[model samples]
Target chain A: MGRIKTTNNQISRREIIIEKAATLFKEKGFKAASMREIADVVGVEAASLYNHIKSKNELLNIICFDVANRYTHKMEEVEASKLTTLAKVESLLRFHIDGMVNHFEEVYVSDREWKHLDNPYLSNMQNQRRTYRKRFAAIIEEGIKKKEVKKIDAATAVLIMLHAIGGIESWHRSTRKIIGKELEENMVTFLIDGLRKI
Target chain B: MGRIKTTNNQISRREIIIEKAATLFKEKGFKAASMREIADVVGVEAASLYNHIKSKNELLNIICFDVANRYTHKMEEVEASKLTTLAKVESLLRFHIDGMVNHFEEVYVSDREWKHLDNPYLSNMQNQRRTYRKRFAAIIEEGIKKKEVKKIDAATAVLIMLHAIGGIESWHRSTRKIIGKELEENMVTFLIDGLRKI
Candidate 1:
């Protein structure tokens, strides 16, 4: 167990550990990725990996909750902003598409790998997600109330918004026929444009 | 394989084999679900399974291509019809959603499990899928030219439509807060209404 730590890094060692583990989990899936491989990738000895994080499940827990919190925070900011419903939605769509592509490792793990999390974390994670989605749906409802948006069902809109961006997962392995910025712009326009009448 | 054949069953025994395999594939996934297991549920002797079908790969190939062909044919029929572009797109939306929810096993394996297929079948399947998406996108472009649909990028619209219904996969396991008919109606409305000026 080699355990010399760097004191100069700005981010906490724990955050770096979670980040690396997110990449591993994104590549190999949560069940298939091992603590040893994560440590190896993170520049730590396998045995001393425990010194930084308690267990693999803890890392999954942190990644899942952390991503959910970030999304909720972003959603809160957009919702609380004075931007028109369309702009708020465009912001939220960009955030999701951005996470799916640019922050591929952490957000992908958060979206797809959180099922492996244990206990209260699992239930809690799902609840947090459910809450976030309902709150998102509420944003659409608010739009309809303001008469800026089409009268489409909010629940259905949220479903489209969430899963629609999931298509980008394939784009990561695709030929990159469309660059990231173009895909992001086109995708956000496709969704936000769908929200309004005329 | 059973040798004792009714000879007059409306759907062929081969169709039955494919149907059962689709169920098993949906439950256990194409990789985890075995031929022996498929035969057992299919009420055929394990050894005679190959007499009815070539291999698991053949079953996957059949399922994937069959679903894609069905979607393509539907698209062609709708495209050639005299329906308005909005109606044509709505019909296509309904077909995809109907396949996703009602034909859950075949559509899901077709959409998700095709990658397990090998060689020419793999390349062929990809080509078929790409053609379908492009044709679908062209439908949007047609609508745009007539000004019945908004001028959002057809490629992006196609992406949203295809991946949006994929969200219904999770609804299979969710509590049936929404019935299949209602969901189909609302989901179709959500996508099709997004297409045009009020």
Candidate 2:
């Protein structure tokens, strides 16, 4: 019982560090923000931070991988929907936008601190994203075959959609300038109309 | 005459550092690549590098600002064209694509290292990009009014298309299955077709 309690406490403390570091890293960047600064914010000595993680790079890697995996998992849910190919694309785009809005900090950290991960870890994260992209492309391919979507390049169509979705983190703050629901509705319609055959 | 020769040499050396640093930043990222490494590649000591620039972050700021400025300049030219709105959008997408393909390294570094720049510098770049995005939205706004584009939220339409264009740098590689020209052509078709009124 004591051992379990101790482990739980350790995990909690580590998470505290990650939360604090994530905010700083998002604001100042991974290279510019130092370990001492992170420890200072975490209310621990710089050396104590080493006890929870091997290095600053490892901490950054954990945060990035965690966020990316969350996005991948959310995308998986979209992939499982019973919608048509075009609808699935729209749903997936919304899911991506919602994810960015809800988890802006995590997504921001993942993108900015991606380089801190070691080679194998970085490659794994990259592959996960690529696989997610391929899943989108597969949906486009299905739409093309069904003649629901114009016979455009499936890869290109999917990539274009992904780009639009992925970039929401950079610009979503100003979404209120137009009614959010109205803007989203129009975006969906515009995308669908663009994909349909004339 | 001696002063003129020294000034030219300084300019030449500064160019060499920027060129080499851009390449290194692309391969290893801005954080991982250091002042010493940049200097070594330029055949100078680490201290000598400071003579050419204020700091590493300043180098990054210069490169990124130039990209934002160049992109805005291209948009200005595209705006002046007498082509149809659809054609103009296609031209804009292609122009942005050409910028990415030709200066992939520089663009990639600028985008990824944006946080390194101080607030004023970063804000300037951000506003410049916002102005550029406004140009795209204005095009869409005009198109909608002219019945060239379907009635939609002009801002969202522009945002989606711009995201699709900018995201090209993340995935465009020589080894990719699609060739550059074909990809650009398909993208143009997708954007125009997606926006056209039925």
What CAPRI-style quality would you assign to candidate 2?
acceptable
Index of the highest-DockQ prediction:
2
Q: Which DockQ values do the candidates obtain, in the order shown?
A: 0.30, 0.45
Please write out the lDDT profile of model 1 over residues B55-150, one tens digit for every residue.
878899888888888887898898789997778778888888988877888998887667678899999988888888888878778888888887
Tens digits of per-residue lDDT, candidate 2, B53-161, equal: 9998888987898888888888888888898887787777788777777788788787667766778997887788777878888987787778877777777777777
Model 1 Cα lDDT, one tens digit per residue, A1-198: 444454587877777788888888877667667888988887877777788778889999888887899898998798779997777788888889888878888888887667678888989988888888888888888888888787776777788879899888767766636888888887876666562225
Q: How does candidate 2 fare on TM-score?
A: 0.82
Interface RMSD of 1: 4.0
* Candidate 2, position B163, lDDT: 72
lDDT of 2 by residue, A138-177 (tens): 8788877877788777777767776775566545557446
Error of 1 at A182 (Å): 3.7
